[model samples]
Target: MKIAIFDISNYHYTYLYSQCKIFENDRVDFYVSKFLKKSMEKEGVLNNSNFNWIVLNDFDNKYKYYKKVIKTLNNKKYDYVFFNTLQENWLLNFYFFITVNKNIKINLTLHNINIFIKCSRKLKIKRLLRTIIRRIAFYRANSYNVYGENLKIYLEKYLMKKNINKPITGIPFSIYENIKCLNDMNNKIKIIIPGTFDLKRRNYYDIYNLLKNIKNFKFELILLGRVKKDFEEEILLEKFKKFKEVILFEEYVSEEVFDEYMRKADILLAPIIKQIEMDGVLEEYGITKETGVSFAAIRYSLPVILPKEIKVMKEIEKIALVYENFEDLIRIVTKLFDDKALIQKYTEKAKKISYTYTPLKQREKLFNELKLGR
Candidate 1:
C-alpha cells in the first residue's frame, strides 16, 4: 500500500519517522518541515529508497504549502493519508476536508483531546469560527487515533456527542530508535524528568519539594529538557541549585544528548500536573491526554514515577510507580534506595513491556486496528 504522512509543524516528526520505519515494506512519503528533515537526517533515520522525504519550508505561506500538500496527495493517489496533528491548523484542515477525495482514507491523530472537545464557551467570533472548522475537519476524517486506550474512551465519548461514529484506534507512541535499556546499578539513582520545565504542564514546585526531602538519599535529579524562555521560575532554579546532585539544562538539549541522558538514567520521573489549562480549556492529564514521559519510560525500559491522578495504559501499569502525594513519592524513592533489587526488577519488567511497543509489534497492532492486511 502507498501511504503519505504529513507533519507541517515539525513537532511530530519523530512520530512520522517511526511510521516510515513501521511501514517499510510499503511505499511511504513523509512530508515534514525542513527542520525535521535535517533532524531525521542527522539521526540517520532518512536513508531509505522505499521512503521519500518531501521537505516543506517553515517560512512558506501556509496557503501555498497546504495547497501543494493536497495537490501532491491527489497526484500521487495515496492509499492512506495520515495527519500526525491537526491542532490549531483549522485552515489547512478545512482545505483537506472540502478538497480531498472521499475514497482515500483520511486518518488523524489527536495529540490533545481537550483541544478538540472542550472549546471556549466565550461569545467571541474568532474562537467560535476556529472551533467550527476544527469540528468539521474532525468529523470528516475517516478514522482517528490516540496514544493510549485510557484516553481513547474519552475521544469516543466526544465523537459520540457529535453523532459521528468512526473508528478510534489506540497506538502506543513509538520508542526511541536504536537504543537499548541498560540497568545501571549506581550509588546515586538518577531520576530524570524528560520535558520542558514549564510549571503549567508539570508541577515543578512539587519536584522542588521532593528534591528537598530526598537529599539524604543517594539519588541525582536530571532535568532533561530545556527551560522555557521568560520563565518566572528563576527562583525555583536557585532553589534547585542548592542540591548538589541535581542536574539542570538552561538551554536547548540536542537529540543525542537527550537520548544519552535517558539511557544513563535509572528512573523516569514525570511530575505532570493533573489539571492544565490550555487555550481556555481545562485538560486533565490522565483523562484528557497522555504524558510523553510514559513513552520515554517505554523507550528506555525505565520504571516511571507518575502522579496517581495520571493513569497509564494497562500494558505499562506494572512498570509505573504511581504516588499520590509528596510523602508517597518519598516512600517510593526511599524503597528504591534501600532495595536496589527493586530497580533491577522494574527494569526487567519494563523491558518486557517495552517489547510490546517495539516497531514491529506496533506495526502489527496498527495494521490490525486499521484492518490493513499484512
Candidate 2:
C-alpha cells in the first residue's frame, strides 16, 4: 500500500517514525517542515528505501505551501493519509475538506480528543467556525487514532453522545528499541521529567517543594524538556538553583539526548496539572487528553510516578506509583529510593509490558482495528 503521513508542526516526529517503521515494506511518504529535515536525517528516520521525505519550506507563504502540498498529494494517489498533528487552523480544515472530496481515506491521530469534541465557552466567530470545521471533519474521517485504550473509551463516549458512528482505535506508542536500558541503582536515583518546562503543563512549585525537603534519600531531578530562557530564570534557575540535585536544559533537546536521559532514568515523573485550558475549553489529563510522558515511561521501560488524577492504560497502571499531593509524591520518591527492590520490581514489570508495544505487535493491532488488509 502507498501511504502519506503528515506532521505539519513537526511535533510528532516520534509517532511519525514509528509509523514509518511499521510500514517499512510499503511505499510511504512523509510531509514535514523543512526545519526538521536535519533532525530527521540525524535520527536515520529517512534511511528506508521505500520511504520518501518531502520537506515543506514555504509554510510562511501559506497559500503557496498548501497548494504545493495538495498538488503533490493529488499526483501521488495514495491509499491512505495519516495526520500526525492537527492544529486549529482554517487552512488545515480546508485541506481536510479537499482530501475528503478526493475520496482518499484520511486518518487523524488525535493528541487532544477533547479539543475536537468540546464546545468553546467564548463562542466568537472564529471559534464557532473552527468548531463547525472540526465537527465536519470528525464526521467525515475514516477513523480516529489515540495512544491509549482509556482515551479511546472517552472518544467513543463522545461519539455516542453526538450519534456519530465512527471507529476509534487505540494502540500504545511503540518502545524505543534502539536505546539501551541504562538504569543504575548505585548512584542517586534519577527522576526524569519528560515534557517542556512550563507552569501550564506541570506543577514546578510542587516539585521544588518536594526536592527541598528531601533529606533522607539521594535523588537527582532531570529536567529533560527545554526550559524557556525567561521561564528558566523565573522558576527553574532561581527556585531550583540552590539544589545540587537538578539537571536543567535551557534549549531544545535532540532525540538522541532525550532518549539517553530516559534510558538512564530510574523513575519517570509526570507532575501533570490536572485541569488545563485547550482551545478555549477546560480539559483534564487522562480523560479528554493523554499525557505524552505516560508513553515515554513505557518506551523507556522505567517505572513511572504520576498523580492519582491521571488514569493510565492497563499495562502502565501495573507499574505506576500514584501520588495525591506534594507530601504523597515525596513519600513515594523516598520509598523508591530506600527500597531498591521495589524499584526493580516496577522496572521488571515495565519491561514486560514494553514487549507488548513492539513495532510488529503495534502494526498488527492497527491493521486489525482499521481493517486495512481488506
Candidate 3:
C-alpha cells in the first residue's frame, strides 16, 4: 500500500512516524507542512534532530501554501493519507476543497475539539457558521481517528449532532520500542512536569503548591518544557530556580538529554489545567490529553501520577496512580517513596500494558478497523 502521513511536524512526529517504522510491507511517505518548517527552526527541533523528515516549501501566504501543498500531495498518487494534526486554523480545512485525488482515502487525528465545539453560544449566528465548517471538515474526510477514549465519545456526539456519518476510531498514541526499562528504587524518585509550561494550560503554580505541602518525600522535582523567549515566562523560570528540588529545562531538549531524563525519572507529573466545560460534564474533562511524558513513562516502565478526574486516567488506570488533587497526589507520592514493592508493582504493570499502546499495535488496529490488515 502507498501510504503517506501529512503534517509531519515535531509535535505530532511520535504518533505517525513511530508506527511507520514498523510497517512490514508498505510504501510509506511523509509530507512536512510549510507551517511546520518555521516551527522547527523556532522551536529548535531542527538543530540536531535524528528525526528523518523532508521539509516543504516555506511559503509566506496561505494561498500560495495551499496551492503548492495541494499540487505536491495530489501528484504523489497515494492510496491512503493520514493527517497527524488537523484543526480549523494553523492549516484550515482547505485540504478538503483542494485535494484533487478523489480516490485517495484521507484520515485525520485531532489534538483537541475546542475550536469545533464552542464554550459559549452568545453569538447565535456565528455559532451556526462555525458548526457548519466543522460538519464539512469531518463529513468530507474518509476516516476520523481520535487519540483517547473519552475524546472519541465527545467527537461521536458532535458528529451525530452535525448529521455527519463517518468512521470514528479511537487509537492510542504509540511509544517507541527502543526505550529500555530503567527503574531504581534507591535513587531519589523524580517527578516530572513536562510539555509547554504556561499559566493558561500547564499551570506550573499548581504543581509548585502540591510540592510545597509534601515535605517528607526525598524526590527531585523537574519542570521540562519550552519556556519561550517571553519576558513574563522568563520571570516564571526565575521562580523555579529558588527551589533546590526543581530542575527546569526551559527549551527544546535534545533527544539524547530527553532519553537520559526519562530513564532517570521514576514518575511523570502531569498537572494539566481544566479549561473548557461542558453542560453536564465536570471541568476536569478539559485536561484529558495523552501527553508525550506519560507515553514515555509507560514505554520506559515508570509509573505515572495524574489526577483521577482527568478523562485519560481511565485508559491508563492499570499503569497509573490516579489521585484527586494535592491531598490525593501527596499521599500517593509518599507511599510510592516508602514502599518499593508498590513502586515496582506499578512499574511492572505499566511495562506489561505498554505493549498494547506501541505504534506498531496502533497501526495494526487502524488497518484492522479499516479492513486492510487482513
What is the C-alpha local distance difference test score of each model?
Answer: 0.79, 0.77, 0.63
For model 3, the local distance difference test gives 0.63
**Where is model 3 more than 4 Å wrong at Cα?**
8-10, 22-24, 33-54, 59-69, 72-77, 87-99, 117-135, 161-163, 228-236, 276-289
Task: Kindly indicate the candidate among 1 and 3 with the higher lDDT.
Answer: 1
| Candidate 1 deviant stretches above 4 angstroms | 87-89, 160-163, 176-178
In model 2, the runs with Cα more than 4 Å from the true position are: 58-60, 75-77, 87-89, 99-102, 171-174, 228-236
| lDDT, candidate 2, at 266 | 88
Query: Model 1, range 36-125, lDDT digits (tens) per residue?
Result: 788778867677787888777867877787788788887787877887876366667688778877777888887778877679767377
lDDT tens digits, residues 1-374, model 2? 88888776756767766776678788888877875556667767677889887777744765566667778777778888886776546767666565644576778887778777778889999878887877776766778888787788888887888887767766455554635878788988888998888888888888888887885577789999887666444656577867888888878988888977887898888888888887688877887777888788778888888888777665588888999888899899888888999999998888888878887877788788888782
Q: Tell me the TM-score of each prediction against the true structure.
A: 0.94, 0.92, 0.79
lDDT of 1 at 144: 87
Best by lDDT: 1
**Sort order, TM-score high to low:** 1, 2, 3
